[model samples]
Target: MGDGALSGWERSSTARVIAPARPRKLAKVPFVELADGRLQGVVSSGSDIGRVYVSSVTAGEFAYACSTNNNRPCGGARGSYCNHIAAMVKEAVLQYGAERVARYLKCDLADAEPDAASLTRAMLATRPPAGDSKAAATVFSRFLRHLAYLEFDPATAPLPEMQWFPPTRAVA
Candidate 1:
């Protein structure tokens, strides 16, 4: 009753103050490096799905922030670039060099992209003479372990034990 009954001047003295302006959204996206050392970003355009974009420091990386079709954030998912985009950019830079990365942006993956799965398969399929199935299996197991380290999230899915062993190491 005391302050409520006070005049306009008294009310002004006790009024709440407004805080300073701040950015409307969060920035920074998580990125993962491939075995080949390329960076990739995880950007969500809509529907919780995002696309990867290759980038360069000079060109500032390609972003879809200004599209009117979607009100979602352009450079990133919600105003800042996301990790998917970052990863793609990093990978491109590492794989093709900065100059090649720029040229790749204009082309599609089918033209000269390296197929990681196929490469991995080929590497694992190589066999040595002496009819060594055990050695072959061991080599394949190591390859799988390496793949798990690169592409898997250790917190959730741990790599399985390699079952292969050299024949010399096998029990008599």
Candidate 2:
């Protein structure tokens, strides 16, 4: 009690948790998140309901990648961003907003209120030297790990791994 000031850890408990940019309806896309220095997640296959694609875009470099659950490279992602990648990006903008998502991918914005389509275009304009297909495996593994948690019984107490996600309005 010699120095009467609260440490940073003490202040953190009382710090206000900021709400998410918007409500995220995780129906079509089960997982979409900004993590591991990239924007990535597993997106449902439009044609086959049973199939899911792992997609990601690295920050700054914008090295994109997309593949199936079994590591088959996405046909549409050969030279440009594919439909699965598009859908994931769209969902990200919805969950995190265009501004935040754009900033995450390090895209230079030209619009006042940018949306998913505009943000994707901006990232593409960067002309990434190559698409990092290697990222697909990492993204898929992370998605699988998250899915494992769903099999557990619901609980009020949050586990350490569950706390990785950004806080929403309910948590705040």
Candidate 3:
């Protein structure tokens, strides 16, 4: 009906968000994002309301880890994923859905119906050859960096710091 030009902030490519079947409650997992070749985010501690865990599952590597922001290894992440890890997976699925998460992680899944639990089960417990602390800290640092964005007051014009960011990133 008009000139074939992309709308503002709209991409002409296949890249777009895959919304969850049901909206997720972000309170439990305040942050969940897919980046840096993993599914990572901050999950509120179950035992201590004041604490938060930085968790991530490396894509393809299938390596995972969970710990406090201060680098305290999660007591529950022994030979298996902790509840915080599970919760992060669930939130990732909620935000991006199961199929997308599986494909991103390159998970070799069974015939089971796709869900966070199934996706979690598919990941092996092989720890990354590198130290988990370094990886977790990187993820945690990113989380804090993003959190800092929320402190910015509303602006009329684009922020100079973010001008280099394209309107939409191509989905890999």
Candidate 4:
């Protein structure tokens, strides 16, 4: 019982505790970088199957955890990285090289050298004209309204819940 491995009644005690089996491949989902040096993403067991939130911290050392069944073995008893970690790393590496992958995981930009031309372009894009506050305010308001309507629109929404929603019926 002291060892990490559980057997007999302990393994069978809970339905969430899945016994060690073949490591199923994970389908990659879009990942977001958190402010606190972590990456969060949702993965599915298969197409439209069990969705679980996966997060990883890649600071000094790399570590990942899943929101699904926690009783699953970490390396399938082989002492290697678990399926979740492996999948996440693979997805990250595919998007970014091994050397740059850490940047996304940690959201660290200290080492990145700034490009003067791009920085200038970005600053100019963000800065408004010298005057015409009323026009800018009106445009900003319209932009906010467009964004708000997007959340209620099904066709353009990416989330499944936001897609194909039916009209809400009022009850007397």
Write candidate 4's Cα lDDT for 50-115 as tens digits.
Answer: 434343433433344443323332232132334554555555444434334444343333444433
What RMSD, rounded to one decimal, does every model reach?
26.4, 5.0, 6.5, 24.0
How many residue pairs clash in each candidate at the backbone level?
20, 0, 0, 0
Which one wins on TM-score? 2
CA deviation > 4 Å runs, candidate 2? 1-12, 16-18, 155-172
Indicate whether candidate 2 or candidate 4 has the larger TM-score: 2
* Candidate 1 per-residue lDDT over residues 78-133, each given as its tens digit: 43333433443444344434334443333223433434332222222332111211
lDDT, each prediction: 0.31, 0.80, 0.77, 0.37
- Candidate 3 lDDT by residue in tens digits, 70-164: 88998877777788888999998888778888888888677978888888877743444322756788888888888999899897986776544
- What TM-scores do the predictions have? 0.21, 0.76, 0.73, 0.35
- Over 4 Å off in model 3, which ranges? 1-23, 124-131, 158-172
lDDT per residue for candidate 2 within 109-139, as digits (tens), equals 7764588888888788877655667877788
lDDT score, candidate 4 = 0.37
Query: Which ranges in model 4 have alpha carbons more than 4 Å from their true place?
Result: 1-27, 32-35, 69-80, 103-172
lDDT of 3: 0.77
Question: Highest lDDT among the candidates is held by which one?
Answer: 2
